[model samples]
Target chain A: MQLRLETKQLNYSIDGFDILKGISINVEDKKMVGIIGPNGSGKTTLLKHIYRALPSEYKKVFIDGRDIENYTHKQSARKLTVVRQENSSDFDFTVEKMVLLGRAPYRRSFESYTKEDMQFADDALNAIGMEAYRYRSFNTLSGGEKQRVLIARSLAQQADIFVLDEPTNHLDVHYQWSIMALIRRLNTTVLGVYHNLNLAAQFCDELYVLCSGHVVASGTPKEVLTPKLMAEVFGVEADIMQLKNGRLQLVINEAMTAQ
Target chain B: MIKNRVATPNGYGDIDKSNISSVKKHRYIASFILLPFLYVLSVFLACAFGSSTVPIEKVILVLKQELFGIVSEIITPSDIYIVWNLRFPRALLALAAGGGLAVAGAAMQSVTKNVMADPYVLGISSGALAFVSIGFMIGGVMLNTKWFLPLMAFGGALFALLMVFAVGGFSNTSSPARLVLSGLAVSITLNAVGQYGIYNAKNISSSNAVVSWMMGSLGGSRWADVWIPILSSLLGTAFFLLNARSFDLMTLGDETAISLGVNTRHLKRLAFIVVAMMCGVSVASCGIIGLVGFMVPHIVRFITGTEHRRVFPLSFLVGGIFLVCMDILARIILAPNELPIGILTALCGGPYFVWLLRKNKGRG
Candidate 1:
């Protein structure tokens, strides 16, 4: 699809306070880009805007050079998918049925599901290693399993672009790395928000660091994850090193105490 | 929260280690065998037992004559008419009302993502009450018209439905929390108006009729009352079934729905109108039957799981059967002078509802 995602001069506000101010970025096709920031620094807000969960006030968000507003919801959904961090619902739907909702973009009202839709849903379940738990009720799933199922649902949409907010949040160590590996293996254009600097540096090809709704740094992990940037942006002292394979890594001396 | 946890079924070292797939298959097979038999039995039992308590043979003869127009040697004209025009219509009415109320309840619960949601949640009953009061005030002039009650009730329901949506701020994107709050606010207001009308009426006869109607009795159901509710319920049921997929998606919440390409705002509007129409017709014909809407859906959920495809159809059948049984109880409990069906439903529904609330209190 030669997919590309771009946000130009994006600005957002909630309750008269700016959340994402003058944010601009371009993500090339087939790369995993990580967006990392402190709490309330607008990572989730930016992802929400891209996924159309929150309306953009002043910005241009384009997918493959086409204006986002020009595409209908179905059209956009068919072209892009999203997996959000927050999971809150009071429903009692089974896991398979909930995952099948991922196919909704392709079906019309009163339309019966086709065999291909079932295939896609089955494939998604297989991809996330949730086939064994397909019949479990959603309320019964663990947090990490729920997150993986959410990812599986987005994959079932067959979208070229993915915008995930904290995709690794609530996962154990093994599943966290495995999920990142799967996202990379899919080779879809990905914009992910992360809290773990180590995971972001290990997985993402490029990084965008935001401080107070402004992009403070944007480059490869080696260039942007410097000790100076960490101290300046996050008020933390960190050591940066390059392994023999030539990958950058960060080792934090200590997590800053809460004020 | 963590320390006070109950002994868990799926916890470490629990013996119920059956996989999810096997558990689901077992549940599906059990329900498949159980529900249909129950539905048929409920229908026959509902028809057989009433205040008059006729024998099965007489009931069959009466039913055959009423349905096929065959002149039977055994059954008399009064028995035939009572069975056909009176009891049979009431049974059918019970089925329609039960199924309609249950489907409406399930749809509302899905759309609102609130367990307490039902046809009455959005002032449908208050609207019907107001219309019934208005029909009484207009008296003989309105009474002469055949469709007056249904039309007035539908109009009032539509008004209340619109009022809730308007107050809820149903924009291109609607919020379910706001929709529920708006419904609560409007229902309280309209109910006050209904109370005032009851207080000011000169004759208690008409007011008493309205009160008993609100308590939902099937005793007065005639063939004429049957047609409107039947037609409206069928239409509403068809609408809900057609959009059952959308209702399933709605429970995933608005953000997930948007991701799946559903315009929730439009769906919400349509569901509100259809549920109001069904309940409005029900109230017009049979007063305000409560609890069938709430209990029937939950009972179906216990058996069918939460896939809307199964839940919707199962709820429809289960709801119909539930009301038929409740109606039979109402008729025979006091024999000859039946109690209101609503009273019995409420008596059962209230305790069950409390237990449900308590069970699910912190799970969410």
Candidate 2:
């Protein structure tokens, strides 16, 4: 296994309040790694540092053993792509044009997208089963359809790594599964922040459970999702079950009462 | 493979990909070729109609004579003077001011990510008007200098933009609401300063001149005054066209733009400077022409969509034609006395702006 992305003791604070305290995580090549935590546990904050949206210390993050700070924004974009839930815009563009914007990192100022670039966009839309909607206005699409189009955009980037921040937020159950499945099929290094523990358990090869800006436990889903850890970290009473299909399922029964 | 069972097939099924390409090509043709032709026709018609109407045939003869030195036996010196000197330069100034304001508005809206942003609303125009008012208070000698007024106006506009950026925070952290609010604050303060300067003017005539200029008129446009607005509008439009892709990405929000490889900070700073220059020159050419900036970009966007490549050039031409038509109406509406172009634009734009606010209320 090769390490594709690693964050070493990442620390971030705002106005004397710590958001991420010496957080560390590793994502290997072609693996889907999930981060799960309660709200305000800093899952999104950690992802921000990984994606360079929030600046990180020079030596804190690395991609393929090279410091992320060494790459210009364009260079880093060619190496990694991000798909976020907040992809909505006030303006509208055709679905095809929206996907074509993924080629921005590869293009120079005033340079039009080439035929080859257009093909990449088309192929991405097809892969996401959205070829029929290519001419549709992006903002006019439903939530699920818009998420699919955004995924296709990430595909068009042709990067080796994908960082998704709550990509299935506000999506229906069907869309959540379908979007997660689509991402799983990419066979790339994926770092995802997921709210649904079951989905994270089923799709992620490994899971990191965050509580109060600390990685309290991390291992295979079976190892990390024990009832005791759930009660302690999530303040919930949960029963872990093994389904006949060889999938792990968590049934969260009730919130733990405060002492 | 995940089954493609998500969305039900709709009318869009019949629209093939090739059809989209053809439609885009048509848009390109309409934007680049047809719009330019329409602009030329509008300029010609504007030359023909004014307080003293010249026939279209005579306007063409003057143009032909001036460009090709083809002397016409039917042409009079007054016809030559009206078509070439008076109406022609005024029309050109109107064209340049309109196009510049529209382009500046588009850029400002994109960079700020607010639909209501324009040079006038953002205090750039107020800054120029304020500086010009102060120049008036300094008496006629300073106003007589060729470059003094525009230079002062540019300085004031730039100062106001910087102040807005400072108050709004030029970084990605600044919200669109913050930027607009700061712009309004700066605009109101500068407008008050301009009013105070006018109130203290030495003569009533100089004060009246300032008032009329503030209301915006192309009545003072000369050939020498035409070049600054023309050159600035062209340069600003060119700079924006080249960065259209970046502008498109910017509309997606700051984090997304950065993730897509756009240097948002650098682009925003450069765009603000360009917009300031464009707005300053337009204001200097013809006072504070309100609402052309806010109105024209919206109209162009409705026609051509939000792609800046199409929107910028089309807005340039369409704005030029729209203002030329407005100026013609201004001339004929009062016959010999001219109505301020700014008043007309405000009358037209105010209602549309209200409608837009209602439309956007849900989104906000």
Candidate 3:
């Protein structure tokens, strides 16, 4: 099955301050689309609308040609999953137990987990290489390990589209790549927000460059990660290159000269 | 750690029907025999081991007669009255109160996502005390009448809960920290009002009775005073049991609950009402028994590993048993003249809460 996500001129405001202003973008089927922006550029606010975390006013956000808001929260959860930036819980929970909670959207109230649900959870744990840490308290895990577990939880949700907000923020290099590699292998449509231009350029099939709550550029990674766009939005001079596999690579040349 | 790793089962490929059957059998055995057996034993020990002069044999005999109408000729009438009428109902009240408080604590912790949360954190008890004190101002000796104290106390608790909700929800949407802070502020204020009423009256009877009530007592409880708390605790505990899955999801916070097909807004409102009502009833009858609700849930979590299905129900049972025993201590510690059960609970609960907080402070 193919899934396409379209955001049509979305606008959002909080406490009379505009967070997302008339922004629009389309995510094609089976493509890894990266949203690159500096902090507070409204990338997260835009992503939140796609997951129905915030209400959008200007137009519609459609998933597979249907209005996302028309679907109930459960129906939307069944189709799309999210991996937000890590925020620890005040209450402690076991890793296995936390992962199993991902199956919640599929079950009914008062229904216990079935064999199939356990199997699905086990498979997810195995996929993330966190099987041995199943019984460990989730709070005891390192930042990188917690991020991987969160991804595993998303996998257990078994959704078609993934909207991740800075998923690699706290991870080590090895875990960062491993998580990206897993996401790539899923072969599903992924829309992710990232601050790491190199990682996004290397992994994303298409890229949306956001600046001050607007889509400044949208195209192939090589086209979007140019020195000009970098200087304009991020206030840095960056070199963009193509590798042997025709994939884009970005290297920050220098910080922009003052004045 | 090595043993733990090795203990984890690898693959289902080698599994057969027999292994699966054995696992199921072990589960059944655990649920049917081990847990319940342990629970019953805990309850009996809790019931029998008070600081009083009564022997276990006499207590058991009285209990038997009460439960099944099987009279033992050896036990005397005063002992029977002490065991069956006075101590038994009081113990049962402590049990119900303890269990109710613990479950309420667990529920409050879950909904608010606060590890230190308890039933009294909402200020229901303090509010109830304020109303009970009001009863004293009007009736002098009449406040000692059974119905007036509990009725006014419950009314006060309900009023406090409503006030807390209003304060928390006044400006922005209600958040846990805001709710808890508001509840604390309201509790302190209501308590001041109650104390002022007592100070103004300054009558020996009303003031001393209020002070004793604040200390928390389950002594002097008769069957007449038993039914309301019993029914309220039963209904409240049952309500929590039914929402076990929701409580589990809620501890993860609202965003997770919403994604899990729970209408968190609705679930939160429902939980608030249930917890408030339970705490209100408990405080009204027991006169501000402290610590059971806070300590028992945390202790249960340490043992059961924070799965609400096990933690919630087991907490109620364990809390009930603990309170009964504590009540027994309160009665017999000074003999004839009683200590308030609340004093012992606060003494126990206060330190335990500090220890838990210190232990987990940096870990989270």
Candidate 4:
């Protein structure tokens, strides 16, 4: 059952400053949508609202054609899981146990984990190539490893929809590609905030470019990533080239000059 | 697959099939059972050892005889008075205070995301002291009722927390560092207020009574006064355990917990109230015992690891035991004079606190 994500006239403000103003977006069934923006562009704020981290106004967000605000926190979590960036912790848990916490939404206040929950957690770890690290202390793992474990946790939630906020903030290049590829392979309805324009353009089926709290441009990567839009919105001068692999490759000359 | 091998910190080397409820849980189960028993033993030992040093067998026989309400004069009434009326109540009070303080500390550490947090870090104890000091200044019927002091202390705790929040300028973006700094500043300010209030009091009592109360004392603890600590600690510990998973998630920070379906704000409010009440009760009964609230959780985690499930229960038991044993030494060391419970806690907590800080020295 594929659900469409729709947002209409979403407005958010803090300290009399508008962070997002009358914003609207829609993600089609099971397609990956990436929201890319420069710093302070309200990309994280938009995603935060969708995931109920902040209070969203009534009827502003709709998932599966029903208002997202209508769902309780637990109900929404069961349908939509979040793979957050920078999940650092002071306390330590085993990797398996961290993944097992993803089952919390399915559990009642008094319920303990059953055999099926363990199986699901194990499978998630296996899917993310983190089964070997199941017994490792969560905080002791390297950044890339921690990110993978967090992804496994979200997967264990068994949600058809996932939202990620700056999903690859501190990852190295290889892990970045691998992590994005892992999400692509999952075939879930994904809404992600990305700082890396190239990665978003590469993996996302649809793209939304947020600039200064507004959707400056949005479409398929090929359609929205024109030279003018790049220069105007991103303050960058770039040559969009179609290489032998038929992938859109952005080559920049004097990229630093735009800033 | 039926789980077989166990995963210890040294890697999975245990081969017993029964030892396989995931390595950490199984090992912790042992400590959980063993530690509470250790606490009971220490309580009994504490009951037996004092200025007079009653025999353990006599103490046990008295306890058993009392359990059945059969007074066959097995132990003399004086010994019985020391063992049952005076010693047991004091020891039980210490256990409850320690257990409650430790659990509150564990919860506070997670809630504040600060390793420096104790049960009273939000100035609950100081707040209680301030209120009690104010009461001392007013004197008369205000201090006459049995429940009056604790209830005042509890109110003071909530007031102190509010002051902390007001001074801290609580916001979603404020780092844990900022919050802790704000709380400490408020605490220092309140401490001054407490001292000033006591110093200027026009009451017809010794000034030492107010000072000793501020420093923390379990002296003259009657069975009548033990329930506040017992009830609040039990509720706080139960709250922490029931929401233990949320506590673990909170260590990961607020945004992730919210996304994972935790009502972070609600849990935080609940934790704050519970910690405040626990600290208030402990302070009212025992006069602001500090070390159990601060170091017991850390010491327990050093051995049991930082998993909340293990940390909470173990800290509760060990904290109780540690304080009781320290109180035993307090009763015996000076001979006819007793040291304040707070002083004993600091004596032990100081070295361990230094070591923990030194171990984490390289990192800011």
Candidate 5:
């Protein structure tokens, strides 16, 4: 029973300033959809509305064709998991302990994790190549390591949909590839905010290009990643090329001159 | 250009699970035994060392004599009365105050996600004392009553905290800044009200007693008054222990917690209520002890890690022991003229806090 994520005519405003207006997006079960936008494009805000972090009107967002408001937070969380942008904290806990907290949604308030829960956490860490760092302090990890651990923690939830926002931010190129590969291999329905268009084109089955709080373009990356769309949406004169391996690479020629 | 992945899933590694589990288990066991042992020893030492200075051996005999009704002529009746009536109840009340405040502090830190937050930061003590001032103004010189002032003060504490919540909370959840500002506003207003109530009470002696009470004291700990703090701490501890997992979730911030199926607003609300109730009860019992609520929990987290399960209970024990020792110093420092326990804790905790900030300043 794979869940499909859909939003229709969603509008969000803060203090009379609109953040998102009439944004609609849909991703089929087990597919990956990427949201690519420049700063203040409302990509993260749209993700928040889908995940129930920020409230939206009833029936505006749906999972599995049912209104998202129909599901309780617990039910929605069990179906969807999120990897947020920031996970840094001064407080220290072991990597295993940090991952084990993913079971929080499944356990009762007074309940402790079971052996099976531990096994799931172990597997999640293993999937992220962090099994060796299980006992390591989470706060001491590099940015990439912390992001991987956070993804592992999200994996421990075993939800049907994974929502991520700029998961590769601050990571070196190697970690960025590995983390994206890990998420791709999971084969779950993913709705993510991606800052890198090359990675978005490479991994996402579909793309939604947001500019100025609106979805300016939405379709297959080949259909949407035109030179004109790049100039209009990103204000960058781009040299978008396809490699022998059939992956797209986007290179910025320069910022547009005033003329 | 496509590149080979830097780190692929190794499937499953042979985890040295036993080492981590054993290390964690050992620390937990050590903390459980060590904290209680320290608390009991401190209680005994604190109960025995005073103006008359009952010996440890006599303190044990007095306990045996009084608790089991084993009449022993080897110990003087005056010593028994001092331990049974004066020091034992005082020590217990100190334990209650320290333990409750520490646990509440731990909860508040996680709840607010601010390491600098204290038990009384939300104006619970100020609000409680403000309400009790009504009793003082109306009845001249009634500080020594058994339960009236505490009950009234508890009411005031709840009212003040609720007002803070109302002011700061939006929709469901509250920001730490809003809560702190609301608390500061409410605290100033309540303190003004209390001052006005006390100064206009028409009796000089009553004014003096009210002034001392506002400064906070453990001198009035009677067996009758002990039950409120004891039961309040016990109940509050139970509530906190149940929500210990939620507390840890919340410290990850509201978005993370909410994503994990935790209703962060509800968690914040629960935190405000439980912390306010625990602090309200403790302040009502011992006027207003300051340092333990902020210091003990901070130290406990430094020792035992950030998990609230250990942080809450360990802080309770550590806090109780700390306050008991502080009270002992209060009694022996000036001998007959005892400084208020709050003054001693502030004097001691102030320096420690300064060092903590200096040490952690580099991290900032």
Candidate 6:
């Protein structure tokens, strides 16, 4: 499989405090890769760099094997899209209009969205099972519904890769599974930050465990979700069980206290 | 359950798509057709019902004769002068100033991402007023030139905008609260300077003139005063309409806009410059018309949705109608002892502003 995204020795700091120190990761085409980390482990910071929200160094990050710096914002948007946690707005837009904005990178400064663009948006909404709420106000939607709408917007972008920053953060368990399932159905390269290890294990084809700005472990979920690594990196005691279906279930026992 | 259910044919479920589209079509008609017709009617009314009431027929005849070269035998010279020279230009100035200020306000709100932002609240008008007052104090060829006052006003407005951005920081990192606070500080300081300039004027007549102008009136408007405001308002509205989609994206927050291929910083800088230019010209034309900017956009948004493509043009026409109607009230309320147009706008807008603040307080 071809590498869809690669970040080599990505380092970021703010106000002289190092947030992401020399972190490297690779995601293959048409695979969902998960980054599991504790809070303040630079998950969001790394995602920011990947999405070009924070400027990354030349040759540090590449999409489709080309340096990310070579692409303009519009070109990069066509190649990769993002679904962020902070999707609320001060003003209201209809779900249709909000999803239509995904076509913005394809539009010129003065050009209106074409009929084809609307068709793409509609198809994307249909994919997320949100076509029924097309006319509803975005702010009026529930948390899970809004997240689904946001994911639908990313789908409308028709990008080859998606970078999601905790897209399921505030959703309920049902919504979390549903959203993860929806993403899994996309069949595009996805790099996501996940707090729930079990969900990561259930959905992700590969995993990178980050601790204090470093990739502490990288492998399939069965290889990375060991009890020793969970206790050492996440400061938690856990039991890993294999079900008859060959899925790994992570049962967190207790949090280890600081010595 | 998900597999068994069939999707609605239109895919909008229970929502009546036709009804929604018809409503949208009506809004477009109201914005494009009805509002403009009302604006024209208000201009005629403004021309007809002043301290000396010229008949509406005569008002129409005067406009026709002057504008289209169709000479009228029924019109007298004094009637022509009253309608054509005095009321027509004054009404036109009111329209231009009102529309310009309102559009500027809408752009300001979008750039700052705050509903409460306007040219008046952001100190742009105060800065222009201060510059004009200082020019009045100088009392030279600068004051006599056609473009001098407006030029000074533009410079002052640009300076104040830069100051606000400097203090508040232009990056998304700066909170909206910081922007509003910086605007308040700049407004207060510039207002004091304007007041001091007027208070220590070398002569009484100029001081009184500045004082009345500061209170905001359309009494002295003439053909010479008409073109700048109209041109600026029209051009500014056109520019904003062309970039309406970007403004829509701006309301979604900066980071999201950036991810969607908008160069938010560049867009913001351009928006601020246009806003400053528009506010400066409006303030220079009709000395400190407050709150028309703040109120008109919100009213337009209420009638239309929050989309700028709908909001910008409607704001221009509605703002024009609003001020023309207000000027009529200002002229007739005391019957020759005219109240300043600004006082009426303040009377209406001050309470609305308070209500908005209280409403937004809960959100914050």
Error of 6 at B192 (Å): 1.7
| TM-score, cand. 5 vs. native | 0.88
- Weakest 10 consecutive residues of candidate 1 chain B by summed lDDT: B1-10
Instruction: Put down candidate 1 lDDT per residue, B11-110, tens digits, no spaces.
Output: 4333232244345446767877887798766766766787676677778888777778876898877777767778788888988888888988898888
Per-residue lDDT of A120-169 in model 4, one digit per residue for the tens? Answer: 99899889876666666777677888889989999999988889887687
Tens digits of per-residue lDDT for model 2, B1-364:
2222234357545444324434665677777777888899989989998888899999999999998999998999999999998999999998888988898888888777777888887888998878867876774776777677777787778888888887863455665567667888999999998888778876556555667778888887878889888988999999999998888888787778888888787898888878878888887778888888888988877666677877787878888988998999988899888998889988998898789878877753
Residue-level error in angstroms, candidate 1, position B85: 1.4
Interface RMSD of each: 6.5, 4.5, 6.7, 4.6, 6.5, 4.6
Candidate 5 reaches a DockQ of 0.34
Q: Which portions of model 5 show Cα errors greater than 4 Å?
A: A1-3, A257-259, B1-24, B73-77, B121-124, B138-194, B362-364
Models sorted by DockQ, best on top? 4, 6, 2, 1, 5, 3
Cα lDDT tens digits, model 6, B288-314, are 888888999888876776778888988
lDDT of each: 0.77, 0.84, 0.75, 0.79, 0.80, 0.84
Number of clashing residue pairs, candidate 5 = 0
Looking at model 3, the pairs that clash are B95-B320
lDDT (Cα) of model 2: 0.84
Residue pair clashes in candidate 1: none
Question: Predictions ranked by TM-score, top down?
Answer: 4, 2, 6, 5, 1, 3
Error of 1 at B117 (Å): 2.6
Off by over 4 Å in 2: B1-8, B11-28, B134-148, B162-182, B201-205
Candidate 4 per-residue lDDT over residues B112-201, each given as its tens digit: 666766645557678877776676677577677877777777777778878877776245456555665766777787788778878888
TM-score of chain B of 4: 0.89
Q: Which scores greater on DockQ, model 3 or model 6?
A: 6
For all candidates, state DockQ relative to the true structure. Answer: 0.38, 0.42, 0.27, 0.48, 0.34, 0.43
